[model samples]
Target: MISSTPTTVTDRDFATEVLSANQPVLVYFWASWCGPCRLMSPILDKLAAEYGDHLKIVKMEVDPNPESVAVYQVEGVPAFRLFKAGEVVESSEGAISQQKLQSLIAPHLAAPN
Candidate 1:
């Protein structure tokens, strides 16, 4: 089994964890039945492990968290939203290449505080 650090987020924790976090965060919106979501899990896991300090990666289930779903306007599964200093900095939907994921998050990673 792929070993990735798991940080589960919900409506109650969304604001504090995703928005108010001191570190850049990657919030993954997905469902258990989503094929693309499953495919991307391993990649996300690897990223979480590799960038544990600089980035905070959290997985959220949309079905169970209506508040987060509506709040983020997540209309589809396998959505990735990057947050920096309590603001949404980037987002992507559907299947994403590992390279693309890195590219999208690189700016936030490199940005000076």
Candidate 2:
């Protein structure tokens, strides 16, 4: 379960990892009690591994990361924000399809050589 998965952005590392990082970052804002959030976990995990070389994927709990959630203006659970060069370039909210989610990040991915 992604709940058990670690290596995500904490309030402590958000600045360096997402805001100042050299690569694109995908932030999944979710809550433990949210059903849709739970459902989106595995899909994100798969995409994380698939896109690891070009993009960084991280999970942020809405319950514990109130600052980030509010800062991003997330109105719903299972929110995804794609950040590049320290700015949000794209965003989506809800339990969306894997294809739709992939489409969201595709443009941000580095082209294969």
lDDT by residue for model 1 over 37-110, one digit each (tens)?
Answer: 98899999889887776788999999999998898888998999998888788989888988899999988895
**What is the C-alpha local distance difference test score of candidate 1?**
0.87
| CA lDDT scores, all candidates in order | 0.87, 0.84
Q: lDDT winner among the candidates? A: 1
The global Cα lDDT (0 to 1) of model 2 is 0.84
Window of ten residues with lowest summed lDDT in model 1: 1-10
Q: Which residue runs does candidate 1 get wrong by more than 4 Å? A: 1-4, 111-113
User: TM-score of model 1 relative to the true fold?
Assistant: 0.91
Q: Following a full C-alpha superposition, what root-mean-square deviation does model 1 have from the true structure? A: 3.5
lDDT of 2 by residue, 69-107 (tens): 888998999899999999999999999989999999998
After superposing all C-alphas onto the true structure, candidate 2 shows an RMSD in angstroms of 3.5
